[model samples]
Target: MRAAEHRRELVTLAYPVYAELLSGVTAGIINMVWVARLGGHAVAAVAVATNVENLLLGVIFVAGSGTTVLVARARGAGDRAATHSAVRGGWALWAVITPVVAVGGYLCREPLARLLLGGGEGGSLRLATGYFAIALPGIAVLFATNVVDGILKGMGDTRTPMRLAAVANGSILVLDPLLILGCGLGVRGAAIATVLGRSAALACGLVVLHRGRASRRPAEAAECGIGSLGADARRTARTGLPMSADFVVRMAGALALVAVVARIGVDEVAAYGIATKAMYVATMAFYSVRQAAAIHTAHLLGAGHDQRRAVGRQALLLSGALGLSALLILLTAAPWIMRAFGSQGEVAEAGALYLRCLGPYLVLLACFIALGGVFEGSGASPALARVTLCGTTLQLALAYGLSGWGLPGICLAMASSMALQCAAVGRMYLRTGRMGRTERPPATGSEADRPWIPAAAASDETH
Candidate 1:
């Protein structure tokens, strides 16, 4: 495809993904708003509960993200059996994993709540345990909805997932007041509302999936290479585990950075917290482009095309523009942005300075993240995950060493770490491009089931 065509396709896929992600974030904020009315204890309870849910999301990515890539590849190959296998793999993995998480989490609710709340026996601890009782079991619905979304996105339908997110979040918005305040269920009400909202969306998603089943007919087991339930599940897990690990590592790194910021001052920590939330608006856009690139690259590769270089270039350009636009906006309106979040005085000043100093890091991060998607689509995610692990560790060490200089020092550490990561990915990209030049397109549909990376590129990444 032409460069213009590739760019256009990426934009089409990315914008809806961005909207879906943004809606989820907005809903979480609004959910917190309603919970905040019950006082600090309620807020604390919901906060920790939601943080646990966020971590749990990484676990489901094994099913959700793996299905996306595999289905996209199968679709491109026009292999109905492969598509069936991919979808089955996602649900199979979900079935095996969900029970352990939901049932085990429920049984350990009180202990989990206490651990999250620093082992307190206060009202917050009780509220959190109550919240967990409902939310943990309700996670099954959330996992199912994510699998539905992955299937849709693999079929190149990003808008449907965006609409589904809106549906779920809208339901939450309407239910929150009624359940939490009007019904007097307190923190448990918040958890209930969340579960009900997601369940409603999942029902609708299932209906959609059913209606579209004609396109994904049942296939002969012999035609689907890894057709057995166990084999399919294992394949999905293998494909997605690296992506899940990457997400978990990043989350852990972000949490660890808070400790380093604490060494600066309490106000700085508060500023860091607020600033990070604000930064999500920009980061979501980068990730959207990344997803777009991954889907597009995988689809094309499955069709026996090696267009990773083209897709990566367009992804970088789109995400780079987004990063530059965000940098300019933050630089000019940092104070206003901080004020809009209801911060003031030392908190606002520190946050504004941090935002202003974030330009280089954001730009570098945008490029690295966008490029990482190309790797994810091409079966190079293990290498990408390793780079993220190293970069995150380096970021923490640098931040601790530079803490005396305050938030700007933290920003410096982030930018430096991201720069190194980008260099590593860039080298991988160049080597892959060189390898692609000498490669022939796959001659059969079964070849689509194989990893996309050439031996030369894979060898380079391993070393």
Candidate 2:
């Protein structure tokens, strides 16, 4: 498709995907309100435990994304063998990562919670641990389900995932309170409910991926098929590491907020929470579109086409559109949304102010997201990680140094860091024709196994 045609296609493909994001966030918002009704500790426990879980899951996502990039483009190139290779690799990836995390999470739940809740006397740590313990094992099911979903999406099948997401969200919304206070399970019950909901969603997503999406023929997906385990593992590891690192950068970046925003008090914290919810609703949709572009770019490059420029342009345009919409929502409807989560009036007001302050943030973040996709699609997962780390590190430094000024200063720090990150990644893409480390350098004795990094090709031609 031409650039303009591609853009329109992207918008169409993204609508249902975007709805998935919106509904998912809506479910979370409802869950939060219900949990909040149980009192501050219950609410706080959910927040803290969820953050830790996100951090762990983010790490896992790095591997998952690698699986998506590898599988999507292979499928796009019309190579049935390579397509299934990527899928198998993704499953293997979860097999490796999930168990380690579950066991570690259950073991370290106390210390992790203490660190997250800051050893407060309010029983926040215990509550967080209770939540984490209940949620840990269920994570395995979540990971497996998502791997199948990601593989399907890599092939341009988003409708099934969205449908699954709706069911998942509905289940969570209904189950969150019922299991928590209803079963006298307390905060642990809420966590249990989320896991169950996720499992249900996973089941739905898996069915669609295996049955509704890929070719029903067993022979087509030979590349990612079960037998090519060695090849899949090698490629997935090389790519997944950097992607996971990017996740690390994000989690670390979020921690910077604790130092910067903590001084503004719990109300400010709650407000930021709500604002973040809104931000995710807007940005995740944009991200879904970006993922589609990544798949497109990978396929094009794999076909020896110079469509990278077009991919870059479309990604930026969509990101900009989504970011602007987020800003508008934040500025106009912050107060209205803030009214629902009323632990304190001041907190709600502060959150409303936060929504306004962070409005322009979406623009800066758009640059970061699109660039990262460019990097990932081009087989430069490590480069994307480096870029993210650069910006996140800057945020941490400024957050600590500027905390004396207040929460708004932290917001400024975040914005500045984003701008710098975008500039850095964009420059790298323009000059290198791929992000740094476009793909992992081949391991010794495995020169034939090298990933398809475009910049490496351009360089070889020059020599």
Candidate 2 minimal-lDDT segment of 10 residues: 454-463
- lDDT against the true structure, per candidate, is 0.86, 0.70
Prediction 2 global C-alpha lDDT: 0.70
Model 1 Cα shift for residue 440 (angstroms): 15
Worst 10 residues of 1 by lDDT: 435-444
Angstrom error of the Cα, residue 203, model 1: value is 0.7
Residues 115-174, model 1: lDDT tens digits: 878896999999999999999999999999989998888888899899989889989999
Off by over 4 Å in 2: 120-126, 215-228, 264-270, 340-349, 432-448, 451-463
Choose the strongest candidate by TM-score.
1
